[model samples]
Target: MLPDQSYHIYNHANGSENIFREEENYRFFLHQYEKYLSAVVDTYAFCLMPNHFHLLVGVKEEAELARTFPKFETLEKLVSKQFSNFFSSYTQSFNKVYTRKGSLFIKNFKRKPILTECQWQDTFLYIHLNPIKHGFVKDLRNWKWSSFHGYESAKNPSKLERSYYLNYFDSWQHANYLMNIKKEAIMKEEME
Candidate 1:
């Protein structure tokens, strides 16, 4: 995680245990993330599942980060530290609630750089469509946990970067159409 770079980061549980056991579990995980990384990263979209979660985020600009953390020499290390803290915060709370101990998520979150418009669009769709892909829901719009819901309900108050879609598609409605029309191919590719 470097400054001003967009990445698709995701992680699953260590075993069969779920990372989110209840609705509050999901909200708490998100709250922890916001508390730790809101200033360090620009959140684009996210999806929290039963045993894993995905996030499409971009590191804050280099100049902004440098100003924010004047004591840190390398912004990458600072960004990584924030993420570590976030994971640790969630793990501690989750462990206590479950009445069990040990790692909740697999070590070292998997991340892929979003280098092009195509990759960014793919990642955005991928993250939003995770519930459907995982069989958690048949309709993406009904999944209240995902940022995809933000697109449909303009009144949805969230920290997500909802306007990112406007950069790729003509409007929010068009963005919705693109995502829906491409659903079949996207789901097919995910299966492969």
Candidate 2:
């Protein structure tokens, strides 16, 4: 895996995509994501498709976000504590509701570092515009499942510093570079 390659993850519904078709499943996923955000992660952006989801998170180097246990004094311990607790809780809830599941996620979470400003911008665009590219909505801002509207419309409060998105270009018009990402990427298996 390259440092800046996007980390894509998925979990099947007992070897099928059927589970994702329900609104309840999406709601569960959102709840779990919020827990992760409130605890282990700083969410810059996200786009939730039907069967899978995408997130761009900045990991804190130290200081755990929440804890039901005694204090953790190391970054490694903090990371492990949050991920394990979050995943376990989600899996239990999912299995109880769905009545089947060996695992709710594929593996230990995968990560890819964003090395340059260009890659960072592209990744953000890719995540934000995903719903649009899939024909889910006519405009990126109309999609309820993504952070594009939040970053672009100021409708959602995200954990990322607003300055990072603003600093990408001289003006939002100049940074409205989202239109340039190839639609062909919609056919790519990892992201689309």
Name the top lDDT candidate.
Answer: 1
* lDDT of each residue in 77-160, candidate 2, tens digit only: 665566667667777887788787677665565555666778766776677767766677756766776666566765566545
Judge candidate 2 against the unseen true structure and give its global Cα lDDT, from 0 to 1. 0.59
* Ten-residue stretch with the least lDDT total in model 2: 1-10
Per-residue error (Å), model 1, residue 131: 0.8
- Give the per-residue lDDT digits (tens) of candidate 1, residues 48-67: 99998999998999999988
Could you tell me which residue pairs clash in candidate 1?
A: none
For all candidates, what are the clash counts?
0, 0
* Decoy 2 TM-score against native: 0.71
Query: Residue 91 lDDT in model 1?
Result: 94
Angstrom error at residue 131, model 2: 2.2
* TM-score on alpha carbons, each prediction: 0.92, 0.71
